[model samples]
Target chain A: MSGSLLITFDKVWKSYGQGEATVHALAGVDLAIRSGEFVAIMGPSGSGKSTAMNIIGCLDTPTAGTYSFMGIDAGRLDRNRRAMLRNLYVGFVFQGYNLLPRTTAVENVELPLIYRGAAARERHDLAMKALAEVGLVGREHHTPAELSGGQQQRVAIARAIVTRPTLLVADEPTGNLDTARTHEIMELLTRLNTELGLTIAMVTHEADVAAYAERTIRFLDGHVASDAVNLEVAQP
Target chain B: MIWETVRLSLLSVRRNVLRSFLTLLGIVIGVAAVIAMLTIGSGTTEKVKADISKLGSNLLVVRPGRPAGPGGPGGLDQATNPLGSKELAALVAHLSGARAISPASQKQVRVIFGTESLTSGVTGTDSAYLDARDWKLVSGRPFSDSEIRSGTGVCLIGETVRQQFFGAGDPEGEIIRVNRTSCKIVGLLEPKGYTGFGQDQDNVVLMPLAAYQRRIAGNRDIDSIYVAADDRTPTTELLPRVEDILRDARRIPPDREDDFSIRDMTQIADAMASATTTMTGMLGAVAGVSLLVGGIGIMNIMLVSVTERTREIGIRLAIGAHEKHILIQFLVEATVLSLLGGIIGILIGLALAGLASLTLAIPFAPSLAVILLAVGFSALIGMVFGFFPALRGARLDPIDALRHE
Candidate 1:
């Protein structure tokens, strides 16, 4: 079965600095991701996976290539328009969870909806539903400091999905958790992918975390080393 | 959307309560300085105006010779040519615009009443002196025309002199000694309070010109002439005509500088008012520098806030907040701080002005327009000074900010 293409990168090139001090963060990247796929990108530090994630999330633009997200040229859009695209279509869950301090879990989850100019009542209801989906039903008033590592990630996930974006991009979503918490977060992502048909692109260094995705892509230096379907994960 | 930004700003301010109050202290002091200076300045101006008006409206005092140095209005020893009754009569006959004219002579003399004694300014003037100087009788009656002509032993005691000589007892008709001469007190003068120069206006004794010249001065010389203009005549029109009349009466040559000088009380009032207004403006400007310093304080704190909340800004940007939103948030926060300080400062300034007015015995003249301008200026300062910090926050690269420790 096939679905609509959500992201396309054709010969994407990105670099930092200029002249002899230049460093290529991404080199001639060509990739396509469909609307309903769960993909994991694996690479060591300095492998340029983070750069690719940033480009794909519309937080940055490619220096010399075409990056089209939802048929709009991500490389050509200005900062404000790119931010607009990110607000409407892409959600990011960072390794640090990145919850605003002194803010309640409900308010944190309501951030994206707020950026999208949602009415207060609707934003509240949607945020409540999002929090409940992450199994944090009665803990909406707790601040990030009050929540455990896994619970904070759950709140972050609620925040990411409240706007109902087409793609959820997570970079090391379980990096800071214990193994048990990591497994719980993995299970939650797997359920969200399977039950809600949410497309996900996750970056991880751990093979066990990579095993949960339907497909895996490995990077070496600034280029992809391998790309293949995960037969072990597809059957499970 | 604006309401949302304001709520966020208030939340951020509430987050660091102590820091916010410290920052507001600068603005509070600045606004307080401005309001207090302006309030007191206008109050002083009102006092000066009232004191000058008490000398009477549309009035002119012709004093012999020009003032010398800082010694005040009596003139130099070399310019000691005084007027006579013949010259006074000539001015009265020639000046048609004059409603009342009086010749004045003065001497400082020790007066004795009951067992108490004090030195008082004993001024010798005609009966029209009360009309020319706008002096009112509080009790008894003024000296009759015949009493002034014959130089009778009769005098009017001012409020301060009355208090000094008679306390609360009736001083009217009581006999009091002026140096060696015993003069009966004919009337009590209404209290005129203090002059602009802080001199007591009620510390004088008034008598008919002939009586003062005969008993106090023992001379025929008149020191000054007081003239009250008609209600229909402005001092500008009345002044030159009076000068011409004086020059003709004194027989001064056309090529020579006039021996006497005419001081228009209205002109003096206007001059005093302008000087006070100028001082108020200069003080306000000096106070405004402190406001600018206060603005710089706001800018400094806002810059620090932006740096401290770098990670928070990163989170907001990553969550798809527009740069404009972040800009508005910080700007509103700074504005709210300054406006709060401005309101508090106004209240404090009002209290200070009220206390000062009471202690100084002047009117409380708080101008609403000045208060509004100060508040508006503080807000404008917030925007002007908050801009750079807000721009720095807005223009931040999300990835760099997020990675910042």
Candidate 2:
């Protein structure tokens, strides 16, 4: 079900400091991901995977190359403009779940919609739908501290999808979960990809977590080491 | 959005109750002091005006001696000619705008009736004295012109004298001894209360001018003259005429300052009121210094709050909050805090002023304008002091703030 390209990175470079102390986080990276595709990014430490993911989510801009999102040169935009782009199209699921502590799961899910300036009632209904989609119907009132780790991750995913974004950028979404919880989370994400056609780009060091994606791209020393497709999972 | 921001700010303020109260203390004390000082000052002004008006309205007091100066004794020079019958006679004869002109000589004298005795102010004045001083008698009649001329031993007893010698009983037709001479109380003076300077105006006796001069003061020297202006004649217009007439009667040359000073009660009232106003303003300015210090305290606490909530700010930023949104939230929080302090301070200040008014016997004059100004000022202080810290929080990089532990 792959469609037209939605994200592209051409010779993207991100560096820190200046001159002799410069450290390149992403160097000469070239990548493309199309709509309805679930792509997994894998790398060792300091292999530029996180930096590439950050650029794709518009949380950061490329230091020296072009980053195009849905035909717009997003890397050239200012901080506020990129923030608007992220709010409109990109939803993020971090490894830490990143649900605000002491906040209820529904409230946490309603956060992105709040930034979108949706009316309170509409935001609540949409957040409730998103939570139900993540299988967190009766747990809407439970705070992040009260919820289990997997449930908290589900709440974070609900927050990411509350605005019905086109792209979901998950950075090691199941890194903090155990094996069974991880399987459940990966399965829910797979159902979302197939049913809603939500484009997903995930970063992970775990091999099994990367196995859920339709395509896999590996980074080593700030460059893509390989790009391949999984031939299995056609039945599942 | 603003309502939402205000609600959020109020929630945050409520979360740290003790810290918010501590931050509010400076503003509270400042506003309290300002309110109390202004309220008491206005009350004092009102009391002073009332005291002067009690002396007389549209009236002037002509006293012997040049006006008091820094280099000279304050209106106590005994060498200058005393205002006497001659000046009184000239004013009565030639002054057209004067409604009444009367001369008075006064002394502290011991008066005795039955077994009771009290030391009271005794004054000798003509029948026109009551008209000139705007005084009224509650019972009996003023002295006849024959009594004023013939040095008759008749008098009017004031409220304090009647209370001491008669005890709620009418003092009219009662005989009281003044000094060594006996006099009949022909009238009861109305209760005039006390002057602003705490002098009991009711503890006095009034008698015929000839009787007081002959029996009590033992001299023909008149102490002062009261001149009341008629309606339609402004005191300003009558003042120059009185000066000219007095100058002519005293035979003073055009170049030399007159030996007698004439005081307009209205002018004195204005001066005293304005003096109190100036004092109030100065005290308010001093209290305003504390408000500034309070503002600094707010800034300090807001800075700490920003640091403590850096991660929260980071999350808000990552979720697409604008810099202005973060700034407005903290600003609203500070404003709410200080406004609460200001309101509390106003109530406390009013209480203090009420207590002062009770003890000092002045009017309770709480000005709504002053209260409103204080409220507006505290809000401004919050906005002014809360700005830098709010900006500091707003300008933080989302990544760096998120990374902050």
A-chain TM-score per prediction? Answer: 0.97, 0.97
The alpha-carbon RMSD values of the candidates against the true structure, listed in the order shown, are 3.2, 3.5
Q: Write down the TM-score of every candidate.
A: 0.90, 0.88
Ten contiguous residues with the weakest lDDT in model 2 chain A: A227-236
True contacts kept of each: 0.51, 0.26
Tens-digit lDDT track of model 1 for B281-325: 999899889989999999999999899989888878888888997
- In model 1, the runs with Cα more than 4 Å from the true position are A228-236, B66-79, B114-117, B162-177, B180-186, B253-256
Candidate 2, true inter-chain contacts retained: 0.26
Q: Pick the candidate with the highest DockQ.
A: 1
Per-prediction DockQ comes to 0.61, 0.41
Residues A1-236, candidate 1: write the lDDT tens digits: 15698899999989999999999988998898998899999999999999999998899999998999988888899888888888898888989999988989999999888788888899999999999999998999999999999999999999998888888999999999998899888988888887788889999999889999989998778898898998898323
Question: Candidate 1 chain A vs. true chain A: TM-score?
Answer: 0.97
Cα displacement (angstroms), candidate 2, residue B208, comes to 2.9
User: Candidate 2 lDDT, tens digit per residue, A1-236?
Assistant: 56999999999999999999999998899999999999999989999998898889888899898999999999999877877887889888888887777678998888877777888899899999999999998999998889999999999889888888899999899999999999989998888898999999999988888889999999998899999996765333
For every candidate, the chain B TM-score is: 0.93, 0.92
In model 1, what are the clashing residue pairs, if there are any? B125-B209
lDDT of each model, Cα atoms only? 0.88, 0.89
